[model samples]
Target chain A: MIKHDLVIVGGGPAGMAAAVAAYDSGVKDVVIIDRDASLGGILQQCIHNGFGLHKLGEELTGPEYASVYEKKVRERNITIYNDMMVTCLTADKIVTAQGSSGILKIQAKAVILAMGCRERSRGALNICGTRPAGIYSAGTAQKLMNCEGYSVGKKVVILGSGDIGLIMARRMTLEGAKVEAVCEIMPYSGGLTRNIVQCLEDYNIPLYLSHTVAEIHGQKRLEGVTIAQVDENRRIIENTKRFIACDTLLLSVGLIPENELTKEAGIPIDNITNGAIVDENRQTLVPGIFACGNVLQVHDLVDYVSDEAELAGNGAAQYILNGGCKGDSVCTEAGNGVRYVLPQRVNTGTGKDVSLFLRVTKPYGKVRFTVKSSENVLAKAVRIKAAPGEMEKITIKADLLNNITEPITVELEEV
Target chain B: MIKNITCIICPKGCSLTAEINEGIVCVNGNTCERGKQYATDECLNPTRTVTSMVRVSNKCNCMVSVKTVKPIPKGKIFETMELIRGAEVCAPVSIGDVILEDVFGTQVIATKNIDR
Candidate 1:
């Protein structure tokens, strides 16, 4: 058994950032375990720039930003086990991982969970189609093109208008492939507004809203696909059916936070985020175990992932040094148009101010975000517009929090 | 003079309009302050990310792709690429390693490692 001051699971943004932060924060012994042969995780395949805007304040590609942190980690002499899959995690912070080197057990003073996320595949969608060679996840297609240097197809039809799909549409075009059309089942696009402009509009790719692929036609490889507009009930409208000739199909349905290890550890999971329930400190219910990045919640930007991971890493270090945060605990709730709150529970008396991260339940214009205790508003911010595609954050002062004896609730109400 | 600018600072690509009146650049239509700067400075000089494939000298014969540690002026992209082509790296080389301390006085690194 290898014992260390801290053991971090997953070598993606969250894990890498956490390890770097912890190491920099005075934790000499830190180890990171990842199943992939290398670091960067999903970012490795995301070759397009637009990743490091907030974190690095520059337009960097996914691999570029990840490399920034990766360099810091390597320089710090952080031990990393690649090609290692963690199968089990314990409340006491013991982890069992299987790698090319065989089974490895790590006992640490603290642990950070940053396993990131996985793509939602066809099996999750119940799309009636035979498993064909030409069908690929948008992310998988991206990896093949950007990393493996293989063009997925010449003519392609993409299912779903998520960021991954939209980006892939542009990527395929850059590689000299024609994206026939991008179809989305939802009336509202799930991707950010800028993505629609830069990745789709600039390329003149048609977007079909409230539409879905009705049937996939092919025997050996994908020959074509039949698409149709859907009613609010989501049933394909027979009159709207159209056949699109294509050699490949890519699905960018959604992403699920990889939480099997969290579940195995008996930590509670959030149905909405599909990540472990964590506080501002990124500590889960299990003591000495913290979570961050996509493993905590799906973030739209890699910069935010690094920012959140820093908190988790510092929090874990604090726990090791002080034996954990102890004080009156207060609960946080999302009300009105708000979707959820991070740091679901707070150590009421901790002197540090709290930064609450949240998302709106729906799109709103001229809205005010209110963080209120039972009687008084702790903090508020007015925004000209807000959308579910963007995650919002607000800070509450510790001085104001000290006056609250009850749980705080955050809400987004339109003016 | 009026200048049209595209803010590539964040994923929110806010288009902006800039006018140089009385030697003071006034910008409008930006979503944030960064966009304002992006517009005002962009009119004087444009900047871009430098990304290209470089031959790995010590690792596998395959080419290892690279990018500037920081974005340089748009006009300097080809110059930066020229400097990178002459660079070589040794293995047990990890991804993100600084292959060149300062190419044209700007740090550049390998984003991925080529295994030997």
Candidate 2:
């Protein structure tokens, strides 16, 4: 068995950042294993701009943002194993991977889970339709068009107004294809507001809020789709049904963190975030193991992923050097108007500021968010607007957490 | 005339009201100076940095992502896309390599590296 100081699964943005951070933080022996032929993960196919604004201080395309980290990893002389799929991770930090050559086992002192996320497919939506050839996930179509150099379809109707769906609408239009419409089951769009304007409105594409694809048409290829308005509870309104003729259907409903290995390792999972429950350092319940990026929670921007991964990387380095963390942690709870918060537990004794990342349950205008312990308010901030599509962050100074034994709660008040 | 513009300069997406009168513009509801500049420029002449992928030859990767060096007139986006669609690049392309130069006074440079 090969031994390494740290092993990072998935060579995407998170893994690259974690490896770099860990290497820079006094841990020289680090290895990254990725299932792809090359590094960069999903960023390779994401050719569009609007990435790296916060993290790198420059607006870049997905590939450009990833290249910055890739260069850093290479400069550090860190070892990378491409086309290696990690099949199993043990509670004791043993990682088993299979690649083109053969099966390899590694006994790692610490592990960082950075597997990212996957798109929810048509099967999860349960839209009544015959299996057709023209249906593809927005991400799959993006790879086909951007990387494989293939036009996915001529006439397309997109389901779900998530960023990918909105982006694909613009992409299809840019490629001289007709985008019929984009439908969202929720009253509010799940995508960033900029996407709705730049991707749909810029191209004169109509967005049907509170609507969904009721039935998919065609047997061999996608002929059309039946759309209908949904009630507040998301049930289809039968009378509002209408048919849109299109050769393709793209589903961009949602993304779920890929955590099969995390589960196999028996790490506790959060029901709402669908990710591993982590602490302020991004360390999971398992000692010597950390989780970050989309494996911890789906983030709207890659910048946050890099930042979160750095925390996990530092946490792993500390774990390796100091053996392990020992302290009482204060539990964090999502209070009114909040969906969930990351770093479910905060170590007050760490003597470092803790940033609480969270999302609201729904969209709201002009709100004040308060982070409070039972005894005193820890931090507070106000925003002009808040939405479920966007992740919110609030940092609590370490000095303020002294002698606090109550669970920290994040609650929002509408102004 | 008054127009509402959503500033796409950042994710904050501030909603700005631009009052244009006699070629003079006044913007409100902007939290930063960048937002005011964005609103004024948007009302006068909108621009966008076009990003796309071009065919690559003699590389394991079939396409290399490219983007304009500077934001071009929004009206020129479709035309720029047409020009990009027909463009192809040979292998050993590095990031910042000019794929197509002088595209509306700006160059379309590669955003990704493609090695043969």
Candidate 3:
């Protein structure tokens, strides 16, 4: 058995960033284990641009953004175990991994979970359809085309207006494939407005809001799809059904954080985010186990993932050097038009500002967000618009957390 | 005429209104100077950085992602894509390696590294 101060699972953007931050914060003995042969993770397959505008102050492709972090990890001379799958993690912080050689066991002082997320597939949607060959997840198709050089399909109909679906619509169009339409079950798009404009509108591909693929048609291969409008409750309207002939169907409904290891270790999970519940430092309920990036909450941008990973890294370093974080944490609640707030808890005694990240239950125009602790209002900020597709962040100063005895609640109010 | 434009410069996605009269553009509702510039350029001539993959011969990883070094005219996106579709490169491609030169006055460079 090998011993290390810190072990990060999944050498994606989060793991690489966490390793770098932990090393900088006085934890020099760090190791990263990734199942993939390379360290970039999903970013390697994500070849498009529109990444790193906030964190790096420049527009970059996904691969470029990942290389920045990969370079950092390499320069620090950190140990990286590539093509190794971590099969088990214990409550006592023992990580068991399997590689080409054999099973390897490591006793780690602290562990950071950064497994990222996976795309929701057709099986989860319950769309009535025969199993066909032309169906592919948007991410899968992206990897196939971007990395493997395979032309997925010629005529495509995309379901779900999530960023991946929107991106694929444009990608298919650019590859000389004819994109029929993009349908979303929700009235408002879950994708960023930039994507809506650049990917769909720019290509003249129509986006059907409050619509979905009612039934997928074809047996041996996808022949077409039945599209229909959905009402407020997302039930298909009978008379609004229409058929569009296409050879391919791409599903980009949602993303769920990949946390089998986190759950296996008995860490508490958040139903709304589908990730592990963590504190402001990104530390999970399990001591010495930290969760960040998509494993904590699915973020719309990679820059935010890097930011959250740094917090987890710093928290892990403190946990190792200072012994452990001991204090009563104030619980955070989501209220009134808010879906959920991350870092479900915050340690007020840390004497540092805490940033609360959240999403609105629905889209709103001209509103204000209020962060309160019982009777005391902690912070307030107004926005011209708020959408479920974008994540909102509010930072509460350290001075305001003094002697707070109540659970903090975040709510949205009309401005 | 007044046009509503969604500023894509950042994720804030500030909604901007541009009024174009006799070649002079005035933009409103933008929170920054960059948004104003974006609105003006959008009103006059719009461009986009075209990113796509090109086939790589003689490698297991058969594709490498590439992009124009600068934004090209939005109208030329399809034409540029057609040009990229027929282009091919060999292995040992590094990031920033020129794949297509003088594509609408901008070079198309590899954005990823592919080993031989």
Identify the candidate with maximal DockQ: 3
- C-alpha lDDT values of all predictions: 0.83, 0.93, 0.93
Which regions of candidate 1 deviate over 4 angstroms?
Answer: B1-8, B13-27, B33-63, B66-116
Q: Tell me the lDDT of model 2 at A158.
A: 95
What are the chain B TM-scores of all models? 0.81, 0.95, 0.96
Ranking by DockQ: 3, 2, 1
What fnat does each of the candidate structures reach?
A: 0.14, 0.64, 0.69
Q: Candidate 2: RMSD over Cα atoms?
A: 0.9
Could you give candidate 2's per-residue lDDT for residues B2-116 as a string of tens digits?
Answer: 9998888777778899999888889999999988999898889899889899999776549998999999999999999999998999998899999998999999999998888
Per-residue alpha-carbon lDDT of candidate 1 for residues A331-363, written as tens digits (9 for 90 to 100):
889899988888788777678898998988876
Supply DockQ values for each candidate: 0.20, 0.74, 0.77
lDDT of 3 by residue, B32-98 (tens): 9989999999999998999998999887758889999998999999999988888999989999999
Ranked by lDDT from best down, the candidates are 2, 3, 1
What 10-residue stretch in candidate 3 chain B is worst by lDDT?
Answer: B57-66
For candidate 1 chain A, which ten residues in a row score worst on lDDT?
Answer: A142-151
Itemize residue pairs with steric clashes in candidate 1. A279-A343, A280-A343
